[model samples]
Target chain A: MTDFLYNYLHVYLFVALFMLFCGIVGVVYRRTLIGMLVSLELIMNGAGLNLVALNRFVSPENAYGTAFTLIIMGIAAAEAAVALGIIILIFRKYRHIEGGDLREMRD
Target chain B: MNFAEIIFLFIIAVTMGGAATAVLAGSVVYAIMGLVVTMFGVAALYVYLNSPFVALMQILIYVGAVTVLIAFAVMLVGPLYRRPKEWTTAGKFGAALGVALVSLLLFVRFVTETFPRAGAPSFEMTTKDIGRLFFDDLVLPFELISLLIVVAILGAIMLALFARGNK
Candidate 1:
């Protein structure tokens, strides 16, 4: 346990995996669009952490991996913004943003 | 264990706990709070990776912008504290569990085999390396990414307008 925890790669990997797990479960379980968006952010964070861990452990001198991680963060931000806008539009149209509420293409 | 290791363990625990709360909590508001905590913990882990810059970026972008955006969305939506009543069904919960379990089992076996890294695991990303990230490494991709973000935001605005025109 001690050695495993001491290894930076293993420790970060474990945390990232756990986050991914929670994100998956949350996405499936949450009925609201907002909750699903939150869960999706969790999944993106996990992927970023996974990339950073690999970069640090495999080739610390290189900056490309780290740059990619930052890009992933950028994508996550864009995704959140776009999703929120959609949520706002959905609420405006249907008066509710529950997943089940969005069952049809047109009234 | 040394003080740094202790801190690392604490961060790991915090991250795990926050993730659980964010997912399993009854309300969307509480999940947002949990997300803030989890993002902070993730930033700390970035520090452990020897890049304070990325760590700060994580805090700034995730904890600052993203969480705040989600909070605003929650407030804009009709209901705030909707308990996860739909999640009570056994089949949905079990399916998620089974997928996670299978992934973890397959991943842990390979993860346990530690790579042979050089002394002390401290691979400092120098300021020059950081500079290259902006100058040489990611200039074009960053531009394209920013453009994509702009397009997404614009599309969202367009969607809102369409929603209004329909009414």
Candidate 2:
């Protein structure tokens, strides 16, 4: 029974789905640029978890999933750097990094 | 469930709960801390999935490097405890609802399809195998990721410099 319970794939999938939902909520509700970036990271991790879980359970031989996950991590790190920089710049210019405050795009 | 299975469930619960808390928390510092806990849970899941190397990398990169950087970013640029406005934009509610529904569907599909075969497949791909595959089969992507990271760093620096100049 222990082995039976432990060897299933649904657990990872559910966890990944939960993370994705949490990320969506964060992205939607968060008012600050930094908060949005954090939510974006959560979403990216959810994607990585999906890839890893699928690779482990369904297609065991292909390292493509793991490789793709690693690449995603790299991309996420890059994204965070750019996002943080942009957030800081926006804060400096507008004196606010609140998502709602960036209403004016054209000057 | 046996002891191991129970432990696995506990770990998964911790991972999921932490991630949820991280996303839901109003305070950015709390969110970062929650992310650390979630990363711990993810590392455990990686171990359960039979990839210890990836587990360590997950902890190291996600928990250690990325979280710390974000924490520093939060601390450096903005008001840490001013309590950001909690109100969301108009269309955001509908978007969140849509994403939640889609995620629920995907979760159901995953659970239904998980139990096709009787047992775990007999495939042993170790860390050495991963290293070999990464270097041999995925050399281009590996090199390109490095290039991308470098460009991102440079762009970030330039943006910071430009922002400073305007002030």
lDDT value for candidate 2?
0.79
True contacts kept of 2: 0.53
Candidate 1 has an lDDT of 0.82
lDDT of 2 by residue, A1-107 (tens): 32465577676777888888888888887888777777888878878887877788788987778778878888888888888887777777777778876976442
Residue-level lDDT of model 2, residues B1-167, one tens digit each, is 56888898899889888888787786888888878888888888878877787788888788877888888888777676675554475588678768777878876776677555445665466878788888999999999999999999999999887777766
Model 1: share of native contacts present? 0.68
**Residue by residue across B1-167, what tens digits does model 1's lDDT show?**
67877888899899999999999887788888899899999999988777788899999999989999999997887654554343546787788888878888777776776554333355779667877777786789989998999998898888878887888
TM-score of 2: 0.90
> Which consecutive 10 residues in model 1 chain A have the weakest lDDT in total?
A1-10
Residue pairs in candidate 1 whose N, alpha carbon or C atoms collide under 3 angstroms: none
User: Lowest summed-lDDT stretch of 10 residues in model 1 chain B?
Assistant: B79-88
lDDT of each: 0.82, 0.79
Which stretches of model 1 miss by more than 4 angstroms?
A1-4, A105-107, B81-88, B113-122
